[model samples]
Target: MKIDLTQDMIDQGLTCPVGKRKIEYCDAKEVPGLYVLVTSSASANSSYYLRWKQHGKTKHTRIARVTDITLAEARSRALTLRREIATGNLTEEREQKRKQQMTYSDLFEEYVTYKRPFKRSIGKDIQFYNLRIKARFGSRLLSSISRHDLQKFQADLIKEELSEATADLYLRLLKHSMSLAEQWEYIEKSPGKGLKLFNPDNAVENHLSKEELKRLVDVLMSDENRPVCQIVLWLLSTGARLNEALKARWEHIDRNKRQWTIPATNAKSKRSRVVPLNDTAMGILEQLETEGQHETLWVNAKTGKRYTTIQKVWQRLRLKAGLPHFRLHDARHSFAAMVANDGTTSLYAIGTLLGHKSNVSTRRYAKYSSDTLQSISNHASDVIQDAMNGDT
Candidate 1:
């Protein structure tokens, strides 16, 4: 009925709340707790009772009165109680009595410890963000964090010259940690609420054309370093991440099944994936078997240690080939493009082969594949001629 309760009504029975809804306190005959009175509309003939909750020596609040109450005012009172319970404000006084138990560092440490056995990159990424997070919000209790704190963290990363995509990754890590806190009931909402990540479309271009791929392969093959050449071929044939390929062990291969069983411990997605090794991929593996360094498939030529960084190797290869700044990881992009271009596999299968968790990540390969397909037949003669002349 939109009736506004006056001060006299509050002193008597009816009181207006924050938004000017009038409520009348009442004794519950049908329900277990105290009740409040409400009317459905301005012209409604009857009012109804809503159950009230009385906090012992703290404050009085309403919970529910009569389930069948149809008055608008009664429903509004019930709705308000529902919100209070949803946000866990029904017993704030009691909740505040417990001591604050954890800080951001404490929670982050828990997250790291829980994720330690899953993947090495998880450990590396946790350490990477740990320094930044501690520098900004170390002293603050986890309960005290808010969206503003996350905003400042993102701003600080931007100020440090981190590209938007990299900064967004750091922020997302924090968001994921905070989500764990939410699941533990440490907080009602994530501090990273309302945060928006920078669009990856603006940052790095990951795809490479077939010509670029041919040029890179040609340069690598002509170099005296045969290990890098084989590495390039395996990367292109398997579409694996650089780190994944570098850390591959002989123990993971099943020659009979023609599959490499990448363990969750070594995979970025924390899920083991079996990549089918094509004949070309198997040939590269066989070539590496002759190198006989360590049990690993790839190793450093100079130190004879398992290769870790492809930075210098990639730089020399690209510079010698007259290619612009493109990463070795682009080989995976080339593989996905070729597979999709030839119509040998669907986009979803391409994504699965690449170890991507979603179809969205795989969709980017579709564009390059579509473009490659249009000229596949026309370019065959030139590709053959270039290979014959050793001018690829």
Candidate 2:
């Protein structure tokens, strides 16, 4: 039904036919397509809407609940939306002129700063942006970025010999930033949505062979970066993450209990967990304490600060060991693989020792046959046992 909508008219209340769902009362005097829907239920909320046709189909956009705003406000918003729909511009010229376009670099700076204080992987975000993303999209205007631009960037990553996983990481950061930009009103919508992620699920854990383990150990023994090497050793022997090992302090460990308590603040899961220290790990700790490598567990003997990253030292060591493809994180995987493949430890037990919150983390190694697992377990079985039992 057509009527001039007013605060007094709506205040009088409305009703619909007994069998009908709701009724529409459109404003004929002011905004042509503006309407108010009054449902059959007396207590139900009545909503204002603006109706239009697109591609030979009727469309309706809700303005607001009648009770939430005055009649004047509803008409004003409806008229504005009508103009936006007709012109394909959501904002008025005054608004467009008031805000300058933000470049990708501007977004990157603001994004990193916003997330830096709490995000654990903020370092990688900065690294990827500076190393790859900034070169391509740094100066590009946020308004000008499209799905094609992102697609081309993804292709270039593959051409440059970057793996799909690495490309995915870069794009994931960019996409999330774009999403935030959209939320912040830099754009109408995110271009990153529906950009197909290139990497597929490959959950296979990287396990070091007997010879590779020996080579890594040999390299660790001779390397000048003794602190980082010990960190790597700690990761391998205890199945702890790099950050966990780096942030560990003397107070967190109990020699008599042979267990280290990871504080909730430092842990990835943000929960305090106690991991038993193996004989090998305990030996490394005892040596560190004797030498007084600060109060922190792993530190640069030369600089007297805790090792923030083992990447630089790891690169040199991996190359010297002729295992350039190996990553420091792979040491933890190798540790899990060793104990899991040995057949003595259950999957749940391995998850607990690795401080994994669930079995899914250890489930990948569960697929290997006994023969395949036994070969991988040869070197680290004793060390893993030491971790489980805290004794030889």
Candidate 3:
């Protein structure tokens, strides 16, 4: 049936016929595929639609509501859709294009599957996403995320009492994820491009002095905290990282050769290295070897398993030694300082001993090497003065 849609008829509230299978609509007189769709009494408002047959299939496309667009505007839009349908563009193709856009959660899943296998700190990344990132932006579309969104996220992290370094880490991870999204074509470009990071003053070196080191060692030897004392002693002697020493296994050690091989899987650099053990390091390993029943080198006597942490016991030990301000990693710094102060070992040799992947890390100890140089300069001055006084 055909009818000219009037504003008075629309205002009176048009309804569909009783027992009709679908909404009863009247075809417009002026436009071929345009119709005034009268919904059932259950619906509050009526809308317009364009219907046509192409390639043995019927397609219906919604235009706009009668309350939103005028009759003249609906007719014009219907005409354009009819022309596109006649030119072989199907409505299903447009719907498929709309579904192709990826959301932030979608891209994050893909990134985890593709990138996490090779990342050393994948656990930390997953934790950050679950704890904060996913809750804030998971449902948002990838293209919808902007630099302002990332800036706000950084601010939120700071407001939550996270340290500046930690907040910077989270922001960096988000930026990295977005970059991966772009590489995989999920996004056109990273929204977090050129975003500023919090300035973390991580360059400050906190090392122990000789007197402080001696006191700490004495306290560790005297205290009942055997596991922490052993771990701290191992760190001081071998310069091994905390995680590396904690995960040490019996199979990797060679007592006869006085070497400990850090596997690529457990190493931060993801490359294996053979760490030569000094007499002191060898003694600690011998003690552990006699005491440990499991395959792992370091095991908690109480749990009969690998020691996961020594944070609390280490704090008490530091306090007992009167070095309450020192951190666990200061032992590593002390090792580098001790080696650099000897005046004989080159910076490259010190770096090799510390398992440093790059010279940039070892160069931080150059300041300690000045002590050795100053001593040599003083000795030379004394020798020159004695020769001049001899007058021979």
Candidate 4:
């Protein structure tokens, strides 16, 4: 069925009959353009589409509110669109030009300045977005972005010897940011639509071995940097993100309940999170609570100021443990892996503790076999036994 559209359709909205049909024509003042409505199935729930093209070579694209276009409005829109097509004035290129004025950096700056300050993961996301998008590709207009551009970025990252996972994260960030741009009408479409990202699921596990973990823990305990030591141990015990642990405050803790409440303002998902403090975590907090004079729980020893940089201390500890390539983030992974092995915590709990916003985040830690799990538990058991046996 083909309906001749008119102004009434645009003003009052049109309902397509229950069948495969198209809008053959439209009236002026009904709509600013012409449309073709397509229904794939007989079911009312099936999506209806409105498609239009600018000129001979321009491709047809989907339009919003296909159902809302009344017959008169549809006809009006169709006639105008036909005239424009005949005159060769309407072009996809022109439409694209209108969209390309907005860039990734524009949206990123807005998100960081306006949306980010209200979220808990602002610091991490700020670093991730700046490094991944705005610092490199952000200046470019969004509509001008193409798969070739992403390919170049990927190739550049590969030349820099960045891992497949790291490169993929950069790509994913682009797609996600562009998706937001698309939603906000900053771009007509997502340029990342056809690009493929590297799959990190095929990558080898980079978790620490038992001896390495023991050595790392020992080094942290013995190091004269007690603040960093406490921070490291707290990270290990609670499986919290570095920034989350760093920005932790005395007010967030409930000593009587042995729980830490991460306010929505400080949480990754913009939702409040409750972390049940383990005995190890509680002990560290009790010790720090007594010593900390600043608003934050973790403080610098030399000047009794809030500590800011743990990078240097982490590097030394990594070297002492004979694990130069290991990242502090792996400690959170180790925590989840160990907990999975012990069967003491659920994957959901582990994710909650680590501020992972999805089940996929915890799933990565649950891939160990029964034997690998036993090994993890055995190491934790041995350490506990040694601690109980008066080993310093």
TM-scores, one per candidate: 0.61, 0.54, 0.63, 0.56
Candidate lDDT (C-alpha), each: 0.69, 0.81, 0.80, 0.68
Residue lDDT tens for model 4, 271-316 = 7888889999988876665334677888776767676679998998
Q: Model 1: C-alpha RMSD to truth?
A: 17.3
Tens-place lDDT per residue, model 2, 69-171, is: 7789999999899888788664344345533567899988867766665578999999999898898999988889998999999999999998889899989
User: In model 3, what is the error at residue 144, expressed in angstroms?
Assistant: 3.0
Best by TM-score: 3
lDDT (Cα, 0-100) at 219 in candidate 4: 88
Total clashes for model 4? 26
Quote the positional error of residue 64 for candidate 4 in Å.
19
Judged by whole-model lDDT over C-alpha atoms, candidate 3 comes out at: 0.80
List candidate 2 stretches off by more than 4 Å.
Answer: 1-106, 120-144, 159-163, 200-233, 264-272, 279-294, 298-328, 344-352, 355-363, 369-392
The residue-by-residue lDDT of candidate 1 on 186-207, one tens digit each, is: 6778888778988668635565
Task: Tell me, by lDDT, which candidate is best.
Answer: 2
What stretches of model 3 exceed 4 Å from their correct place? Answer: 1-100, 130-132, 152-162, 203-205, 224-227, 289-293, 372-392
- Regions of candidate 1 where Cα sits further than 4 Å from its true position: 1-102, 119-132, 152-162, 289-294, 299-304, 371-392
Model 1: lDDT to the true structure: 0.69
